[model samples]
Target: MFSTGSDDVGVRKAFFGSLVFETVEKTNGATSITTGIDNPVPIVILFVVLTIVFTMMQIIYRGLKQRRDELLKMSGS
Candidate 1:
């Protein structure tokens, strides 16, 4: 196992990299695990995407709650 990036939530998205391994004697005792893409760009992009989604959800919830509370208050009045 190999990792190339910080272990933090903020940057963990960039950790969306790859993993590589070899069976040692598979196709002929040769190399087997060779991959790339271990950066922070993907991680950051994912973080932003999630943040947007959560933010929108929170906004919608807040608006619905506010409307419900207002309706209840009006009915009480």
Candidate 2:
């Protein structure tokens, strides 16, 4: 049942099948791990979150500073 024709079709089929499988495999034989943010998503998200937090903090600080200055002026010398 292995012979597909009078010639060596079984050998040809096995060879082509192996080549196709190798090409279709996703891993591609990669076995090593990497560090320090392989993708941009985590770093980008962290930067965005920190930027927003810092901006809000600055806004609150400015507001409080203005209120404190106003109170000092109202108290007079």
Candidate 3:
């Protein structure tokens, strides 16, 4: 005979199985959440490349400014 409350062992077993099923459902939901997560590597690479390019550009600009300053000082500007 089966009873439908926690006082009965069978009901406790059923409730445990339901909890396990719910956990599997949540795991599958997480899998779908990451479906598009794999494509961002290229975007990350592009961001890093742009950062390096901008850093180099800033260094070049500073170097040109220093050279212009020296040239002005030599020409009495």
Candidate 4:
């Protein structure tokens, strides 16, 4: 039988049939696990790529709208 004696510990180790398992628990004033992105470079690159793509799309849309308006004016005149 294994007992930690306290529930506020950070790490607990258990052994079962030649296998050892480590379990981490977060308690008050203890170090917690990081669940966020580890690298920012990839995220920044993706953001820049998406921004450029959206900007190009907007430019193309505006050009098409202008061309359509010119054609309509020519047909009406």
Candidate 5:
């Protein structure tokens, strides 16, 4: 279990499952508690997006390098 330094929030992981708990205060001096199981869907989406971005960057870099080499060769001739 991990506490966020306050007694109001905590996170815990066991085996392949994760749990999150939070406390919220209302303006009327009342408090609300919220609990949920953490989802890996957002992590998966972020990983996929980062992979696509890096792949595109690599492809663009290689293409630019190849084009530069071709230009250099033409100028040398």
Candidate 6:
């Protein structure tokens, strides 16, 4: 507990021209443990990609089905 540079319960300037304050104080400690959902960006991106892929797949499937029906009708006629 070596006190240095005018640490007698008041503000003082150090060698590098920095202000230092020393005081006696007390207060009730306030600590908390917080819980939250983390890394949400990747999950959201994954869902978005899945949605886009499924939508495109459905569009392609419907187009192919329509093309097949058209060909079938032409062949029958």
lDDT of 1 by residue, 1-77 (tens): 42333431121122445322222224555433334455657767888999999999999999999999999999999
Q: For candidate 5, give the lDDT.
A: 0.70
TM-score of 4: 0.57
TM-score of each: 0.53, 0.51, 0.50, 0.57, 0.58, 0.53
The better-scoring model by TM-score among 3 and 6 is 6
Which parts of model 3 have CA positions greater than 4 angstroms off? 1-37
Where is model 5 more than 4 Å wrong at Cα?
1-6, 9-37
Full-model lDDT for every candidate: 0.58, 0.52, 0.51, 0.59, 0.70, 0.57
Off by over 4 Å in 1: 1-37
Give the local distance difference test score of model 6.
0.57
lDDT at 20 for candidate 5?
59
TM-score, cand. 1: 0.53
lDDT of 6 by residue, 1-77 (tens): 22333534333333333333334323544322223333456557778999999999999999999999999999999
Pairwise TM-score winner, candidates 2 and 6: 6
By lDDT, highest first, what's the ranking?
A: 5, 4, 1, 6, 2, 3
Ten contiguous residues minimizing lDDT sum, candidate 6: 30-39
Model 1: per-residue Cα lDDT at residue 71: 100
* Residue pairs in clash, model 2: none
- The window of 10 residues in a row where model 5 has the poorest summed lDDT is 9-18
Q: Candidate 2: where is the Cα deviation over 4 Å?
A: 1-36
Least well predicted 10-residue stretch by lDDT in candidate 1: 5-14
Better of 5 and 6 by lDDT: 5
lDDT of 5 by residue, 1-77 (tens): 44445555344443345445566667898766666768766667778999999999999999999999999999999
